[model samples]
Target: MHSDKAIITCAITGVLTDPGQHPVPVTPEELAREARRACDAGASVVHLHFRRQEPGKGHLPSWDPQLARDCVQALRAACPGLIINQSTGVVGPDCQGPIDCLRATRPEMAACNAGSLNYLKVRSDGAWAWPPTLFDNPPAKVKEFIDAMAETGTLPEFECFDLGIVRCVQMYRQTGMYQGLPEYNFVFGVASGMPADPDLLPILLRLKIPQAPWQATL
Candidate 1:
């Protein structure tokens, strides 16, 4: 067995998800409150994504280091010993925002997108749900994130959207971009990526490096 137990992680709020429509928490206090509730319900880790705090702008993502710090502090105070998992999935190359957040928060774990993907979704009428864009995370960009995580002593939870990306993480370790056994986060339910299929677990597990910690994100 890989371990004696499973660590449950609850995502507080996702980027671009409108708080008005959903129950996504925006402010630091709100995040802390929700995180406390999640902890009480059995979540030991809280995945964090800072959102804009200005009124009516809570739906947008925020990379403000101060905001990230505030949120982390609040969560720590509300739920002592709870592990923090910061989200570092950003598009394009300039990853300074996530890097800054990693330094400021010094979270126990942070997401490291394993590969690029065509972030897309389609409506019932064949119309695009949102403008098609690429969640670009090239080799250079991935390295930058890995370095930041290392500097902060943060574990990189490799977010693998597909089978090939899962393998890329192994290459990352082999190529010396990152050291130690990589933690895997097999993401599903994305329209353009892997499906939420139970049967695929066996294949993914087979490909993962032995004794590596892993989890499924849906």
Candidate 2:
């Protein structure tokens, strides 16, 4: 049996959640409030995803560094010494926004999706959901993100969506593309990727290279 206590992380809000339609927080004040609640509830870390502040523009994500900075600062003030894990996932080629946010906030950790996967979904009728999308995370893009995070002394949480992507982390280490020990995130329960089952955890754990620490999130 595992003896060590698990670190709890609260994902306060996500990207592109309609602020009006849903209860997700949108403004800096709201974000900080939620972070405080998470900290009070024993969350050591808060995973952040900034949303657009403009009303009715809630469906889109924000890339403004100032906005990111404000949110991080607010959270820190609300919950002293709370660890922040910034989200750096972007769909298009330009990653400048995420890079800028990292520089601005200087969070303790940031997510670095090690590989790409099809951001897919389906309808109740077994039809395509909003068409298939290649959430591309090429080697070059990965390298760029790694370098940026390294500059700020921030830890990169490698989010692996599939087996092949999990193995690619090894390749990244071998090629000197990313330095230091690897931190893996096994993300499952998507329509196109791995399922959420405890039975599969052991097999997935076997695929990880030695000397690397890993965690799972459904």
Candidate 3:
């Protein structure tokens, strides 16, 4: 890779994706192995989401402190220099789990879901696929997460799923909640979020703080 190439972030695991079928890691061994593979393939960072180990609960997200620390330590040993960016997303107002993980493990970076989005989907039959869930990340909650990250030396990578959420990061910067050059992820192509159109990429890029480090997460 050249010095000019954009840093690649491999999201090795995601929220609520059932590990029963998918290859997403549900244990520390798998997490470390997958992270090493991504790093060897030129990914500078790996975004991680821990899952519960209890029987039948392997699909649900977990913020267990021990799991977080074990995964981080194993990843560091396996990859040597890969960046660890832990997922801190959870629906509703209870953020203690995420906060606990952040404080306990204190990864190099953490995902800061910038705003709320009505988690939506549609069936092929022109009806709701599932009940529209409120994936809440209100200002107060965002502030709490940001403050926690600040305390732990973790850089908050704002995950903006929509245009308004993209703009909100700027507001967060101005309102003294964030004091450094912002980092952003312009997430699109979701049913209830911004469209993932090529033409819109530049437009979205233009809306962000000039020269801020950013990446496009498909």
Candidate 4:
């Protein structure tokens, strides 16, 4: 069976880029404006990442509860009925910033990285593009985020970057920490976890649990 309609999710801003250089929205007003524009362009949901608005701190992610509250409120007012999916994909073992923002803003959904990844990249000359650090999302950390989301009445959007992470979702469900039908975001194009190759879609689909809502984010 196939449906002609699709739910488009717009990620108005990303955490990794500097807004000044990339031209993405950084301030609350900018986010609200762009989010409304995305809704007008057929987006049913808006995935958001809050950024710092200091004079020279635009490149960094901001975890301030007030900032997140402001942005979320503006978006909700601008785009009525739009689902908000907040970003809680921080790399640290601690969930202070992400958790605080989630509890404060209380979005409809929040991203929960299902597993860890050795975030790495190499240039053509075999030189390291950046530090080969670990994007660690251990089971305990995952639980921490989940607990916060649960408290805030938010749904978890598990971000599975590789096959192993996809399988881990089942284990997480079996452990009783997760309590509902699954939601997955298959992330590709990263130099580490999984590459964005169409040839691998079948294998990835085979690895997923049947009857769960899933989508790919490149």
Q: Provide TM-scores for the models.
A: 0.97, 0.95, 0.94, 0.95
Residue pairs in candidate 4 whose N, alpha carbon or C atoms collide under 3 angstroms = none
Backbone clash count, each prediction separately? 0, 0, 0, 0
Candidates in descending TM-score order: 1, 2, 4, 3
List RMSD in Å for every model shown: 1.5, 1.4, 1.7, 1.5
- State which candidate has the highest TM-score: 1
For residues 1-218, write the lDDT of model 2, one tens digit per residue.
Answer: 97988888787776466777788887899999999888888999998998888878766778899999999989999999898988999987899999999999999999999998998889999889778989899999998889999999889999888888988998999999987788988988877888887888887788877768888877
> Local distance difference test, per candidate?
0.93, 0.87, 0.89, 0.89
Q: RMSD of model 1, in Å?
A: 1.5
Q: Which has the greatest lDDT? A: 1
Q: Estimate the lDDT of model 1.
A: 0.93
Stretches off by above 4 angstroms in model 1 are 1-3
- The order by descending lDDT is 1, 4, 3, 2
lDDT of each residue in 1-218, candidate 3, tens digit only:
45787789998876577787787887889889998889888999999998888877878888889888888888898998788998999988999999999998888999999999998999999899779998899999999999999999999999999988988999998999888888998887778988778898888888999989888888
lDDT of 4 by residue, 80-127 (tens): 999999998887887999999998999999999999999998999999
Worst 10 residues of 2 by lDDT: 11-20
lDDT of 1 by residue, 1-218 (tens): 57678779998796688989998899999999999999999999999999989889998878999999999999999999999999998887899998998999999999999999999999999999999999998989999999999999999999999999999999999999988899999999899999999999999999999999899999
Q: Over the full model, what C-alpha lDDT does candidate 3 score relative to the true structure? A: 0.89
Instruction: Judging by TM-score, tell me the better candidate of 2 and 3.
Output: 2
Residue pairs of candidate 1 with colliding backbone atoms: none
